[model samples]
Target: MSEHDKPGRIAPYPRPAGGWDAIKFSAASLRQEKVVLGNLKAFLKQNQPHGFDCPGCAWPERRHTNRLEFCENGVKAVAAEITSKLVTANFFARHTVTELMRQSDLELEQHGRLAVPLRYDPTSDTYRPIEWDQAFALIAEQLHALDSPNQASFYASGRTSNEAAYLFQLFARLYGTNNFPDCSNMCHEATSRGLPGTVGIGKGTVTLEDFELADAILIFGQNPGTNHPRMLGELRDAARRGATIVSINPLRERGLERFSSPQHAAEVLAGGSTELCSLFIRPSLGGDFALIKAMAKRVVELDDAACATGGERVLDVAFIETHTVGIDEFLADLRQESWSLLIEESGVPREEIERLTQLFVRARSVIATWGMGITQHRRSVPTIQLLSNLMMLRGQIGRPGAGLCPVRGHSNVQGNRTVGIEERPTAAFLDRLAAVYGFEPPREHGLDVVATIQAMLAGSVKVFFGLGGNFVMAAPDTPRTFEAMRRCALTVQVATKLNRSHLVHGQQALLLPTLGRSEIDLQEGIEQSVTVEDSMSMVHLSRGFKPPASDQLLSEVAIIARLAEAVVGNRLVDWRALATDNSLIRNHIAQVFEAFTDYNRRVAAPGGFHLGVASRDRVWKTASGKAQFVVHPLDLDTPIHRARRQYGDQAMVLMTTRSHDQYNTTIYALDDRYRGVYGQRDVVFANRRDIDRLGCRPGDRVDLSTIWDDGIERRLNGLLLVEYDIPLGCLAAYFPEANPLVPLDSVGDESNTPTAKSIPVRMLPHLD
Candidate 1:
């Protein structure tokens, strides 16, 4: 059999990341999408000064230095958007919803772009084409028929433009509800909740320029090669400058070990990979809290030793005294933590933790970056705060090259929250919005993603509206979430392509096709531009020059405006006029938020402008007016650990991960090149010791079930085992497939984000 015919073959990738293979794969994506010649111009326009931003990742762009600013994944995203394949009315007529649900996510995406609006026909069990006006009117009728505004939920995805998100929030509030469930709640909500109490801001404090001046970079729970490939360029430059780099993750990811910049002709042609990290510390799943505390304890011990010897102080006492509070309490808690407990909880040796602390002491400037792996745990908020406490010892905040960086997943997830797509709107934000719009906005907190699911299942939330996402696939507890979706009275989705969400319908469902990021958005015979904010808080203009996929498709801004008009009839605001001019929406936004002063004029400048962060400027907005050092106990008596202790060798912590071939919920292919599994995504990665302990051999098929207290039985069968480099008692699997194992109620304490990285599961070998 040929290599492609193999189901679950294990072979290590020979070469390092980003060489000629990257270019070849990118070309393959273009050919598969049938955009080989048409996407050439899009490659030049992406991430440029006056061009559209990439729809793939949230990594900030640099000044216009190179002609090609897009990465391999960015090329794939653009090619998919500008593909010649179309899903017309005739295509939908060929298949029923029940039939479509059986296809794999990859096959569904391969069918291509949705051309027109459609509505579900229950009697026929098919989706039939519907006119835009009639669809909007029907949605309005269902929403109006609801008993209260709280009965309807509005969901926003991460890729939505700032203009569309602002309009969406405004409309939802005007209708008298704060029921906004956004995509950010799934990934980085821990950063949003943890940062504010300690650093007085919810966003990252570092800029793109800070990476160039750093003496050390510590990455935690992030694989930038597959998720944010462009970050490899920055790490490559930092490594070349003799900077010390360290990575703390359960798996030794290839992206952090070494990388070759695809943009650099010399490196690609010479086949040389730059060494990224000096130290790779492997911590068990959900162990970051204990790991960070261990590092802090060692730092305090070193400082005391230095003081006794009359050597230079290791800690920055002067800066800490002036800019921070609660140091005494933080240190006391650190001293109470035992060495044995720290080692056991973190799954790292004392020697390794001490080595990491010494590196931190020697580097003058450092940047601590983390991803969802650190956020999707029950103790995620406390873990982030502990990290902040460790950095405050050296007074790393408000410096040239030292601060916190929470790498966001989607290109515009942060932007959506910035534009008020939030369920728990602050009093100040509501006041300003009410003052600007001349109406009373909703004051009570509303349902988030988790709450929305529960409310829907209880039959309280009747109507559901989504703005660009596959909600069924992205949410946790796939079986339960699918049932909740079916309970909805009316469901509406605005997207560019078909997804699983459209197949899992409510009593009545409407699918509205919208323009993609790389397509022209003409409004009232004039072209318009929308803006997006990157992870580093750089807001820039995105203008699309290519023709749209279908003339029937509408811009997100236009769709929201017309729907609002149909529902509310434009009382105080002119919805029709705002739909034609995005500047008008910016004008309204500038009036509500002070940071957006002169939004239209400022964003028109090249490379856009930066939204100033208070913490970065040494201005704390906390109640104490100073940075606070929070204290968290070193404890690992969580649900997963308890289950492991009770079930003995049967329980293992499973973490859901993204494959190299996929973006969020969109699956591009079945291959995960980095971990070396091809033609299948059902394989599980486990340490060799764990494999032996579980009585499983290489390539053995097993049935996995969740070890939850809830009576619900969630099981996934026929998963092939692959012996790999992972921490003991931990197994790794791809997301959406493994999402079923994560219970809906198992979430972070304050953030309410699902613990996708800390699931307790039991393995049963298949009897074959």
Candidate 2:
């Protein structure tokens, strides 16, 4: 049975983050995964020079100065990837598809690594072993049978290597389709879409070194303790160095409040913790847009006051005049904005907004960082641009210690985009691809994640191919997404282990087992190393020393190359050569993308090379040749706000969160140590006043029914309520479990990212 059906404990955690508990839990994870201590040699190499990058968060690596370069969650990801257990054909034979569906996500992953290729057998509701060549042939047949290339939707996960992602995109385009719906579409698409027009770069401009030199760090809607544990060290050092750290999130994250490094024996032994955040601001869910506007308003107000008093100018007038455009229109909107409406919309007191603004003003240099919380909202794009406006007012960009940083979830998610795994490819990028290779790439844009699902429901998208990731669990509206997947004529998943997406198959499905990130990738009697780009746009080599989980497993590059060969054939480019030597693929990448010039030799350097961002050099790529301060009208018509308008006091905004034990869709354990939830994944966090006002009690089990105009009755049942530190009228729940509450149509404007962070929900009495 699923763990969601089980009872769990909720208690207050007495200690700060990353103490003895972190070490214990990490060790427990390694033991649970059956990774012996002797095998830990590979773990030590994580994030080190000439070593593989951690397959967890996209946090950049600093110069190797310590023995242990991995974090607690990094160890969990490493343990899960290099586990000794195997899911052989016998394991599948023992459990039918219907039976396996009853198992929880954690149980499915814990069954271990997939050892061979499997093809779905509808007659027995089981998967049978299939030869690699035969599997490729089946895929090619399905593609050929498709009415049009657009009928096939190619999806990629962030876990894919640069070489593999490049090959995957190349294959899809060569086959004549731009339907690449990637994981970035769900998470950082807001940053990708928003930042380009404003700052001329979609990715973050800050480097790890910038964090060290920053005078103040403003963290927005991100919890570093769980999502990016390694970042805690940086935050800790920043705090110790007297840098002002401001945490602007709904819940008071333990990671942001205080962090005790597990690696530091002195701190752990002393049972003391370093306070991370100087100020903590809790805004309502989806309130960042208004909160940021309020801060910007305060900045302009302070500047006007300072000018009137003949004091030092608060606004960098000279810098603004030189480096920015649209300031007059932006300032006009800010000046006209009502403080009462801003306070009501943000649910933040005017004093807190002023305090945050003062911190931004006092700091000589600042770094603004955010995560999915800032991206998964209706006004996410404008909110980010507003943040840019705040930074530009102080001349923060193009400086050593001040820039924008979006903390990406997956290890290579940013890299995946860098290597052409995008649905809407730029004409210049397509032109470069056509010039480098001997083919005319597709010029028309293609379907993203949400569009792909809509197409599948309409029976237009027939084939679904996934490079990696559990698409069923990752996408919003879990049941509807599953149904959409089931409607596909053929589905193909290239993965390392079993997931819900594998069982919820199409009319015909193929499961191609691939090597994990920790496995040795050998091609043509030589070991091959893959490259990945960290969150900071640093492209580095990732080489694994361990043997493959099974001999049947192939590297992701090999799988894509062989599949491409089977379908497209060796007409334009030699797929076989590209698969054997990743360097050749790197050469192709360099030719296609100018940033990767001399990719092979440059990546071989110590700590790898940074693919430079133009925004850092103040070279804005916008039409006006200056940073654009685009303005957005105050949007109270967002899903949550609309629901409030319709439902009165019953409406509450909900956000999906990741547990400490899990990364993305992969669950390692049930315990959320930081939140003091033991053995549970089905709990909702709410403010005590909301619980009381709503006629609900702590520990009450309830069902969350999403409020959408589409009339689809989407609900997740039997969630235990826990009164906690959060803003009024807002609730928090674990992702994938709470993913059901998010309507597929409810997405960020312009970005098209599912509004997982701001779902309008109504609590109902638990049924069944």
Candidate 3:
């Protein structure tokens, strides 16, 4: 029996990625879904040309995908979505909203896909079934009642299709509000903000095929085991082909350690796996800036040595002088960043830094990728700029097998941003959009995720409209966010399943049920296929095969189009026509976004077409008309220093993490299989030394309090401590649950992204 079967014992999980355990888990999920042989066939079609896309992650599919084109997590996500479960209005009538809110987030969503539109009646304390027309009318009434257009905030989730996102943004702009707060604002806003200054584009320059040619790949702050299991196959293949894979993270991840591919029969039969990750470096939380700077320093010094002693220099001086600017100023900044300070902050030895530099120097081509771990910090923008500077020195931006790759977490997140889900839209983009749609788009910038919460708290925002997400649970300062949301006059969620966001409602709230990715979407008389972009900017068509769960369910496109029609009907464009046909929306998208030219014609291709990023061809769209060597100063007050000065000597930097069985705020199970955590979510992972120093034992319950000058006490209670491999002066807990401890004011510099991974906190004995 698993540790979940027991009450208190926290089991320690061993073994690497894709073992027999993965197979068993996949089988268990299928069994739970009550899948048949036909369902198995449908599962195999995922990520293919004719089938639906995997709703789990944004990892790019191969040009020619495999027959079994999904990972274990992909299977779990599909199974979860296409489950044979029902949570009818009668069920809600039996259980009050107050009583439902008391259940876990997992339990709330596990109530299953909503079959019809619902309206929360506070007097009854339960959701009542409502007509779609009535729901739209109610929303339109509330929206028009708002004093100003700016009083409303529109949110878009990453799961939204490109067509739906385009129409949704168009509708919002036509309705007169640029207050577009999206999922990207919370996670990768730093990458979307920082990289454009140097690379001319916010997206990654490398393609999926580039991984095959990479001599050395540097992965920073991402774990592929639980978060992105599909990436493990690529890493495993790279390792088998003798490529060097380097990992820099706080914890030792099993995905980078070894992987047993379920595809390989020999490996499965022999119980063997391929070893990945040539080098693993553990840096202190928020220490990536110093660590990367030290590596850059070593590279510059080595180049000087080679030039002075008569040898080929490490840096591509041609590329630097011709393709880049401010190299001299950048080197000056590196020289001032002392090795002693770097070693002290980075917690990486001088020898390791030198070794990392040597690997860079020897590599013919390199690809440096990062995830939320590097982005969810106070200095995230500067840190990413430093990474860009490192890439510039080696001439990696425009070369084959070399460039920066900011791996997107959600299915169509990058696509949504591409199709105009940005708060800060360029004048050129707006001008083109206006030319196509004949409406003056909002010139004023809009509120992001954090700013939206602040607006709601100040009572400046009256309406909260979400396309698909649990904003209250996914955001920082959960208690504050929950209260802020309650201040809204109206809250609307266009979702497929029930979640905590539905419970933390405004005075009036509506739940608009939509079709899932696994279900068929029939707009008029014809079935429609949606397009989504992957991490590498590859857009492909996804057509669902399964029947709709309920006849009352509508597609996201239909809902957005209907909402637009009800609010602002056909003034700018024919909203009713766009609802019936998604191709028209795609044409509108093509006219607005330049890269998506020939949208309808090209998207019909076998693997779909690349947006063809100009940065990939050595084109730098910066103000200087070339790639830039942006300088980032190393000396600053990190989170740890601020915590010590404000809270006490015992304050530690806390990081919000996700469980193995979770996707964003949606919890699939209460257990985190890889971490050996089971049947519980109220647990914190800490170093054994830190636990002892805190006068706490393994499994000892504790309370966490945040350290900040917000003049408010942010605390989380009833957390059990678990000893694990991590840096000292750091604590790890799952997000949404731990979001309460992160202050709303604690945001990344210039990026405005929440510093969820680097909040300072102190652990106290649980009195309860």
Candidate 4:
């Protein structure tokens, strides 16, 4: 097929109110198919109970209040799970791995859930059914055959429960390697690494209840409306209460602009979308660091003004003096930063910056929330630290209405990290783990996702095992990631459905089908419930209601247990017992980590419990027992220039994003309703002048190539252009499809998060 003929290659943006149309469009799509309302009804009721949490977003539930707790995307998530489609051995027999690879990610997922354990036979290029025991034995043999434990890398998805993740990490460590690379490396590694230096903990310090009391909410780099629909209700409620909600993002996201909560009966019937952001500040792509630094400078200025007037110190003098260090140095660095640099870098006018600063100064309490946008940049870690520093200056931490909120993507992503899923495990944590498990844990830091892929390409890594994730597609530089997976001696995936990662077959691969969170988990003739931690540090239990789609499907814990037994035969830990009883798993966790003391008992309560954020009590965990301010000398090596260069004409920096109808890599439909895009996912939204400058018209074919070190290139033959209210020198496109263009080597300086938000790309006429 020609490039132009491909779906998503060339399509026009839909008219405004496309979201309203999408509600109809999706309904039509569902009407044509058999609806499984029974499954959905039962599944939603089991949410936030003694079961596994929803694998979609990290938005907290409202204390299990209503019968209908599912959001719009949550509906899509559960519908995708309860999908009538199935990919059995027969389906695999019909299509070769190569043939499946040619299909789109949507088409791959549409093939449906894997009904049984399947092993890839390279000779036939098809996956064949394999017994669970045989699958475990094969994986054990391949891992054991590796020259060293470092040659094996363990990848995890955010979907895995805390118990399952704990066991997976324990098993990997017991096998003698810290090569644990996870999804966090690709998304929020900056927050995970940077927040600890600013606050006492790596996770968010606020609870869901804090939103109700917050006087001001500053949302940075997050589009909660689509990515996290449930958050809209909270934001809407906060807005209704007259709290100032400021949105800081490069794009004017509809979610941040306005949201009509489907849950709100009055608004839903009246067709009214509540106004969300009181002030929407659009910063340039990769300009978050500069903008935050400017905000901190403003705070310093405000502090000086208040001191000169003999008024109350606006800089939280008490908090800083007691719990922080290096403020003087940070102030010096802020004063030295030129206004011209801040204006040029942030893409926001000086007047607008002053206006935002004034609002911050006026607010008595503030809550700062951020997402991947801030984390996927060159100075991601420092940017996060700066935000934390700003919050500290305002005395935001430890209060009911003020704190730091890092909007985590997955339901259990935070939980996984909380329970021994770190690439760099501290000596203290390892010692505790050793004391609990009765074995010396490896002291070496493990490889992250990017490092693991690089090691695999370098042939230093051999076996690859994913607890739950589409690592090949989710990772940056798809071609390289896929090649690395194929080069592995053995690949094992524990998943619920068929995805692009499954098609990227290894020399020998095994697909261990696992039960989804919505499905019932029966073990040893008893029902089981899994636990997950939210982004706000609230731990809750999740109980499944609907029966398992496949009788052969096993819970994640069961799969891990079987693998551990096969690999570590007669090991110190009782893997089988832990799998059969999650309480025992919690007991082991409590023994290892102090934070999880009385884990089993505490989790049995209604909403579980709070993990306790030490920073909330004004405790700083830095070297001097106080929050230390670190200064970064700005690198002027690569300045933003619009002139034609060796790479290409100085085009806009394109930040790939997910459409309203999509989540992460999952494409439910080909429509970004909020952006007025419909029946297509390949169209690029750009300012009208950009198209004219390139001598291209709407629906013109174009190729986008990144000028990054890792030779990764992506071209979309024809994309329908749309004139939008976007800032100059900026472009927006859909993700996962555009993920291939983001090079593996182009990562944040300190956090190593793939720079998915800031890629310098050039646009050109499509070659016939």
Candidate 5:
């Protein structure tokens, strides 16, 4: 049985506490929303340029023209970071770790900003305030006592600045551990791992400038309205200019349907939202490979027909000859794919596939963009390769208005990977580091996020240090993750706010509060700026404006510096000097990484610089020295169910989703306004036919359990059913709430990302 099946476990669905009216009341409370425009403007100007990067999504800035670059969620993210509210020692003194664990994620966020360093005391069961020196000294003791560096894991968030990230990786290596488990492991690990094989670089090949010139755009498995709100503006402009924009996702997200940019005064006043997606393709969860293959097969047929009819060739013959390899194999696989199987798997008609292929064949330039939905799957890498292959067939790369764009969530997630947050370090990167930094970097591949958790569970990992992410709660299989964290000898979190992960205690846990991007970071009596790499691979400077919420709070850089000093000693590197002056940190970075050459001078300019994208110039960095096409054959075998011997029937597939009002792990409110979901987080969206087939109706409570090979069973008690326009035999529900049903072992084929988007489950009535 799954952990949730236990007697005392909390049910996945919680009854609506105050009802829809109460939720509406709470949402309406923001109508008279106190505008922080003045503060925002001043802060944007003073802090944005030189401050730490925003911890939100990695969508690029609009040329840094005006100060109003941030979005609503960005504001909340910033405010949450630079809030006046403080979580002092007194607050933690009153509540034990166990008590805090009982609080909802929203309540934990509402507890406000963490103000000082805290250490959990087992006797009192509360976190008592500890001095920074003491905290560092204690952490040092644990690190020193570790039998081997491999026993420790260093976890990082995408929010960390380039300088901090560089220092973090350096510290991990110098400390003798390459076990760097980071945020990338959970989200775009597939993109990082798979893209390099196809395109020389793991990052997106396109720049923001490419978006303006594209004739056609394909958005796959991403909702811009909620996750990356600012991107909606770009899509709206692109759609307005007559660009063909297609959206492919499991849900018919309203964001892809229409968007009224709050920035567009006339549009908002007229109650008009711009029409987005010219065509919306609803594919089955984890069915991207099937969909893309069907499209590819159609493209090949069109190419052959064109040649026979004295028409222009659909495929870019010259580009293919000069810049790519393995096309024949890929094309053969596509040609072999059966239309019936594609139709059944993709949940899209063959006609729709032809239409999409025709559009691709006709477009002069096309940009393919995708989000976590594509990356967080079993065939994530292969799916990405398929996208690259589709683009290459039309000679889309190495030109304006056409390329691949991976829409990352964190501000510097791409940057972190760029600067060396990876578990797998290249020999060239290590050689450069040794030549410049005077130390041989670890060559052995390190553990990723999943591997780290598994290591901890097996008693192989002892110390856990997170640079700035919520590890426990954000990871899949919460019960296992929490227990693994608890098994650690020590756990250290460098963060800006209180999260559930903070309460997932170790033998000794340290909560080291840090300054946010919106706050002034004073270093050595001089104002300093931190750099962040955006989704488009543009490296820009971010400076903060408001004074820090607490004087006790340290910058992320300072915390890392102190920790490094305590653990690695002053001989390896002067941590104090580097912390005192960010310039020193940049200089050190420049010495080790060739990409950051003259980092200080380049960032001093009005607009930050773009990291070199090799694909832009047709420099393929793959092993074959050409863009490679990978073939992924479709597998249609469904696992047989032993329980079905007693009652024969097909199991349903459920995709976990997020509400419009929520960000990853942080629920802003209960209402999912865009989808017409109100004050109800426990409702599951299903097709009316499916409900009837299951002997249920709308508003019926049902228990959903996963049908996995392992005898694990997860149930969501009292989940209200809502009839929706979803496909038959398919179900959708919000994540974290439904996360319990996803087994940690049920991960992506190559990426190791949990298949949260596609889980097979059996349902039962809520008899209790």
Candidate 6:
């Protein structure tokens, strides 16, 4: 394990996004990954129309002809995926699981890609190489031996292809369980749960094309510079087009301040960058609801003032009447909202809200995009509703340049759910699956990620299988999730690299290495191209060109099919043929999903096809048959309100974020160049005022304890606190390191997504 034992270096970062730093860093990544220039050139075809999708983010490709579509983070992801480094059986022989567990999260993943199937040997505390057939057989035996199908839990990741995800869900349902715990359950479950009821679609209403025409774009609770670097390009472009870009977050993000696109040689050479955000608002953690509501109120006020003088109405009256429902009640609720409470909770001045209101009033087109910040709170569903309400008020949905965009994290996360990787399957979908596959599909609701954690803790779940992703690092309540995983009789991780999840194993664990997005999968001499849906509903084919890093590596589709064959034994489904030809899998997918009517033909086209969203067509599939305007009364939730009452007003609201060098759970580099922190993950970023208030100076060593309702007292000790530009009484730290502070039970109202973005913690200076 490559541990960052040395203290981190915090320095001043003078330049904006891009410039020489972008070029230098990307070059460093290629060098670190030991990629040959030829291989690197081939890998650079990522996200191309005829090439593979970058595993970094779900940001859609602009066009096939765009010289450089990938971003800095995308390059890092490609370098990591196509790295020359390998963690083979020989490497595993040198280290035990216990010994590996001692490595830091970043170090554990840097051990390199898993090259072969390896099973954990509990007696030796080491991983030994195993044959694929025997490994699948062991998993099948354990699963079959379970008292009930529900006793086994299956997890899918956002990285899984649409074909693989479809097959995985199909396998689970055929096996008589809906126990699908997926990455979506942790990230954007709020959007998945909140959007459909309102807009008839869970995905973003705006397309990549919309970015060009937007008058204003409001980004909330997300940092594009680190998490989704490609978005910074779009933001830069939008800003250059004179769009008013507004940023609402707990901490000021560099990407929002300004961006210099490395793709533009002139900008890099001249050190010139575009200022991205017109107005940057830092709301307190969990203050998004109040902020959104207040914005809505101001918009309505502006509309009323215009209507009073018999002037042009700010609200789209005709569109509202024809396409919306429950607006009257929603407006009433907004009108009655308390300004004092909203201002206090949101931590935004009334004048700032008024300024945004004026911008909204003036703008004819607006797109409100949000990320984990708005979704990882207790009131996420309501907060999303507030966003939807704001959009619909001005008839943003179905419009040319305005809509609701929930920036999805993974490359194909939205598509995974689109292709049926959900715990709660719709009866219509199940019926279609049963008819197509000639098997009785599971109708009962299954365990999501959090519920799966609880099930594992109860000792009911014996077999745990993950298609992709590092679950241990991704899940909240890290200690508890690890304990639950350990309770499983057998655990399986079908992945690209060795992460903390592989080391934190069950009684018996299997590390089944699989092909990454960058690697080609040929079955029966024919190369395969898998499809992935972007943040928008655009479904495109991703064809890998590079050979597999290891001959032993199998594609995720092959792995899932083989496992299903071993376990369920292809009575109704031809798992073998599906594995051999991906087209057959797509055909089967088309048969079940109406959106994929001509899936094969459409995907074969140049840029693939869009799954024409219903809301985009102004045909709502919702219960109302119109866009629904739902209102949530503004108030602090029980947990947060209680914590503030008990721990005083100074209690810091801790938010676990991705570093500049990370993409979700994968750490590409140790340095957070944008935040000016290098070679460490143990440091916490807090406000200067808060540090002074707590009687601490910059770089003071501290320990943070979660102020939980259950009083479990989850504590992360020996953390170095750095006073920085965050809201007072708010702290920012990178995740998996801070995952333990997020309680398992702390979830959103309807989404049930882990509240990883907001955890109430009290940090004290370490005397030692």
Per-model CA lDDT versus the true structure: 0.91, 0.91, 0.88, 0.80, 0.80, 0.87
User: Per-residue lDDT of 1-768 in model 3, one digit per residue for the tens?
Assistant: 644545455787677678787887888778766665676776777889878998889998887876577888888888877876767788889999899989988788677778889999989999999999999999999999988899999999999999999998888988888899999999999999999888788989999889999999999999888877888888888888888999998887767888898877688779899989989888888889989999899889988889999999888899999898899999888877788999987878899888888998799989999999999998899889889889888888888899999998989999999999988988998899889878899999999999999999999999999999889999999989999999999999988888889889899999888988888887667878899998888999988888888899999999999999999888778988988998888888888777888899999987798998878898889999888888887755766687777766588888999988788888877778678788888999999998898788998999999888768999988899999889988889998899998889899988899999888899888996
- How well is each residue in 1-768 modelled by candidate 5, as lDDT tens digits? 323223222232222112232234323323323324445453355324444455788998755556556555665565566445678988988898888888888778777789889999999998888999999999989989999889999999988998899889988888887898888888888888888888888888888888889999999989887788778878888989999999888777776777766556576656577787889888877678889988888888889889999898988999999999998998888788899998877888888888888888899999999998898777788888888888888899989999999999888988999888889888988888788768877888899888998999999999999999788877887778889999999999998889988999799999999987777888867877788899888888887777787999898889999889999888869999988888888898888777789999997776688888898789999889999888878765533123234335547778887776677777665666656676568878888888888899887888887777776666777788877767776788887788887778878777888777777777777887
Q: What is the lDDT of residue 576 in candidate 1?
A: 97
TM-score of candidate 3 to 2 decimals = 0.98
Q: Which ten residues in a row are the worst by lDDT in model 1?
A: 1-10
User: What's the distance in Å from true for residue 515, model 2?
Assistant: 1.0
TM-score (all chains, Cα) for each model:
0.99, 0.98, 0.98, 0.95, 0.93, 0.98
Q: Which stretches of candidate 5 lie above 4 Å from their native place?
A: 1-52, 637-649
Ten contiguous residues minimizing lDDT sum, candidate 6: 1-10
The per-prediction tally of clashing pairs is 0, 0, 0, 6, 10, 0
What lDDT tens digits, residue by residue, belong to model 4 across residues 1-768? Answer: 322224543343333221354355445444322446566464446355544466799887766565456566766776677676777888988999889888888777676777999999988999999999999989888888888999999988898898999999999999999998999999999998898877757888888899999989999999887788778888888999999999899778777777766556576567776787989899988777778788888888878888999877778888788778888898999889998898878888888899888888788888999999889887889889888887877778888888899999988899999998989999999988888778998998999999999998999999999988888878888878888888888888889888888888678999989998888888888888788988888878777777888888999998998888899864698888888988788888888888889997888887788898888777777677877777765545542342224544455677888887777887776767676666677767777788888888877767776665444455555555666666776777788877777788888887998888887777777777
Better of 1 and 5 by lDDT: 1
Weakest 10 consecutive residues of candidate 4 by summed lDDT: 10-19
Tens digit of per-residue lDDT, candidate 2, span 1-768: 333223487777878899888898888888899996667898778888877888888998885446688889999999988889999999889889999999999999999889999999999899999999999999999999988999999999999999999999999999999999999999999999999889988989899999889999999989999999989999999999999999999989888888889888899999989999989999999889999999988999989899999999999998899999999998899999999999999999988988888889999999999999899998899999889888999899989999999999999999999999999999999999888888999988999999999999999999999999999899999888999999999999989878899999899999999987777888888889999998898999998878898999999999999999999999988999998999999999998898999999999987899999999889999989999999887886677778888899799999999988899999998988778787888899999998888677999988899999787899888899998999998999998899888899999899999999999999876867
lDDT of model 6 at position 174: 81
Task: Say which prediction, candidate 2 or candidate 6, comes out ahead on lDDT.
Answer: 2
Model 5 residue 105 lDDT score: 80
Q: Candidate 1 lDDT, tens digit per residue, 220-321?
A: 999998999999889999999998999899988887887888888888889888999989999999888888999999988889889999988888898789
RMSD of 5: 5.2
